[model samples]
Structure formats: structure tokens, C-alpha cells
Target: MANPPLTPEDQERYQARLQALIVEHRDLDQVISHLAENPPPDQLLVPRLKKRKLQLRDQIWEVEALLMPDEPA
Candidate 1:
């Protein structure tokens, strides 16, 4: 189902949240890379961190979709 239209204030909030998620996402990428380069990779921690990254990606997409204009038929 499509989300209801967001008010201007809501858009601002979402924009802020989106920026935060993007920053966190980038930071996670760096952390993951650093972890991978170490002598021994983390057998358990990497997967959990990856899962959180995936979740952030999904959230980013959702917020982007919300900001998109409706298609005209």
C-alpha cells in the first residue's frame, strides 16, 4: 500500500532521518571493511553488522519513495 502524503514538517523530518541513515550506512561500510582486513575475520559480528546495514538500506529506499511524486496516469 502507498503511504499517505507527508506534511511539509514530516518531509523535513524524514529528510533529516534519511541523511542520518546514509551517514550511518557509510560508517558501517567502513567498519565492515576494516574488520575484514584484520588478521582474523569476525565469524559472528560481521553478519550482525551486515544485517543492520541491509535494514538501513531498506529504510533509505522507503524514505526515498515517500519523497517521490505520484505518477500521473
Candidate 2:
């Protein structure tokens, strides 16, 4: 689906939200990497991180879908 162009205010808001999401995704990815290196882990963090990562991935996909106006569906 082609995305419509955003107004200036909407673009600013979208950029801010996208930046925050990218930071969150990076933080979760780092936690997952750190967990892989350590032994005797809490065991719960992996699933949580994986779940968060999936959620963030979906959000990223949605955002990219919105950003790419001319992309083919």
C-alpha cells in the first residue's frame, strides 16, 4: 500500500516516535546479546526480550510501511 505524505507536524511526531522505537529495539537487542555471554541466567529475560524484539520488529515494519510512499504492495 502506498503511504500518503505527512504534514510538517505529523512528520515531526512520527520521526520522534520512530527514534524512540529504534532506541528501544537497540536496547533489547543489546540485552539479548549480553545474556548470551553470561551463564546461570535468569531465564525469563530471554523470552521477554524475544517478545519485545518481535513487537518492535512489527512496529518497525509498520513505520517503514508508512514511510515508503511509493513501495509496491
How do the predictions measure up, each by TM-score?
A: 0.84, 0.79
Residue pairs with clashing backbones, model 1: none
Question: What does candidate 1's lDDT look like per residue over 32-62, in tens digits?
Answer: 8988887345588888888999999999998
Q: What are the runs in model 2 whose C-alpha is more than 4 Å off?
A: 39-41, 71-73
The local lDDT score (0 to 100) that residue 29 gets in candidate 2 is 91
Give the Cα-based TM-score of candidate 1 against the true structure. Answer: 0.84
Evaluate model 1: give its lDDT. Answer: 0.88
Model 2 lowest lDDT segment of ten:
64-73
